[model samples]
Target: MPRSQPAIPICPPFPISGILRAARRRSDLSQRELARAAKVSAATVGRSESGTILPSINTFATLLAAAGFFLAVVDPDGNVLQPMKTRDDLRDGAERLYPAHLDVIPDPEPGEWWADIYGLARPPETFYRDRRRRDYQRRLSQWQVRVSKHRHLPEPRLHHYRDAP
Candidate 1:
């Protein structure tokens, strides 16, 4: 007899969008209708369904309320899921982090592109530094908004240059 491969997990860690979609379907609610009930835009529902964006904590709470489901999330196996908020999880779960460097470089001059390619004009180092700072601030703001609605959870601590040598 041949050995069988192990079964893979069918559900995702969060699967917030899937949960919302299921609830909406069970209620015969259109995305626009659900969004209206949740006091959010239809685009929000569409994005959530597509897994393109994770709703903020407040938004999630509102959605669950509208769907008549408790705010708690559960795994497919009926296990209650704990919050998985962490730097790495956020990095992976979010659409994208604010770009660390916002300096947009144009294509090099037509004929001179290959000449001293390494010496091409680059944005000032300070430009990158400023962009990094701004990105950090933007992330912090989002974190703050999330934590505000989840008052029971400890706030995330922001550390600058955490991995810099």
Candidate 2:
């Protein structure tokens, strides 16, 4: 029997159409002019604004840039979130990215590595930690610091809201 493909989740429509229209107005650019600047078809700009089509992330960002604006990711407090740094220098024997769940150690001492038992010489500066040992150390630190009892709490209520019935 042929295997069935998993259903891809469809995202609900966003207010990107309105945002693009507003940005175009602010930049004083017609749809055709914006399209020319963004190197897209005028129909594409029109359809995007009319909600007939949803632009891909790259296309949306390009259109916004043409309208003298840029897209950004921000928190509820309006703080811009920075993207995670890429560590191109770090990799394993197969050159695949280190497992994100585990901590990676660099230049470990001899006999500390599992592959050392086989007497295989590893590439320079490549090292790994035992997952169980790392987890044990993390748990021990949490217990010593009593992290469970003092876990993060929500912000306090405002003074005005405190008196509200």
Candidate 3:
């Protein structure tokens, strides 16, 4: 059975999606426009901002890239606390070159832990690095693909939703 996200915390207030919404507004892009740029559906953005959605890692990454932001939990002075990447970005990259294995399979024995050939310890960073690498490769490939296909892709303004169709 799949587990669900814990209830929203009341104190420090996890409002990353709010940041996305604000960024989208700053970009002057509608939900549909942001969705298209992010390669996700507009409803996804709607749900996320409304707090009805718990975005996958990859989805969040796409949103960040689309909204022109990077993922980093930082202190008031801008010291990075947690570096994060979206799962969708990694999965998409993985899908392009190799089969994506972005998920962590839980140990059935509950106490068991296994290290893979990559020498990743019991708790591995493979999942994070895999997504980050994939995100970079996918963006690079998309740029190449577009340049080869279209002679030019404008100075990267917000993509038209109709263009996606």
Candidate 4:
């Protein structure tokens, strides 16, 4: 058998200091001029270019804007990723933001949800358990119907849950 080589992990470029310096030079802006434009101190701009301290996202964006540049996030294939819009209206009973991974369904039908068995009126919007649980329950119910019609028990289908980031 031939020996296999280990896969090398790919790292994205992150030369922020170099990028800032280049952008400032390209825009013909001195450190003090850039600082004044960005509403930050000249020392802060110098320290950022020298990599003495890393700026926050907002600060970095501001600095870039002052140097006539803008920051953007792109995928490996160079596709720009837009930020998700904030949903101010949707909220749980405790007014906490729902997990982004879960799907939010609006106005579920009666007895269509597991929580409906409590006899309380359904909320206007809600999120259920992961899809695996719902799929398993649906398949199990169908299997039960088949078993009743054939007068014999059969192995039921199974589902697996996928964890979300």
Pick the TM-score winner: 4
Q: Rate the local accuracy (lDDT) of all candidates.
A: 0.64, 0.78, 0.63, 0.80
**Candidate 1: tens digits of C-alpha lDDT, residues 38-82:** 999999989988899998888877877787776766766789978
Worst lDDT 10-window in candidate 4: 156-165
Supply the global lDDT for candidate 2.
0.78
Query: Model 4 misses residue 140 by how many Å?
Result: 22
| Deviation (Å) of 50 in candidate 4 | 1.3
| TM-score: model 2 vs. ground truth | 0.58
Model 3 residue 21 lDDT? 85
TM-score of 3: 0.40
Ranking by lDDT: 4, 2, 1, 3
Q: Candidate 4 at 37: error in angstroms? A: 0.3
Off by over 4 Å in 2: 1-13, 100-103, 109-165
The root-mean-square deviation over C-alpha atoms between each candidate and the true structure, in angstroms, is: 15.8, 11.9, 20.2, 11.6
Per-model TM values vs. the true structure: 0.38, 0.58, 0.40, 0.66
Please identify which of the two predictions, 1 or 4, would achieve the higher lDDT against the true structure: 4
lDDT of 1 at 162: 53
Quote the positional error of residue 137 for candidate 1 in Å: 44
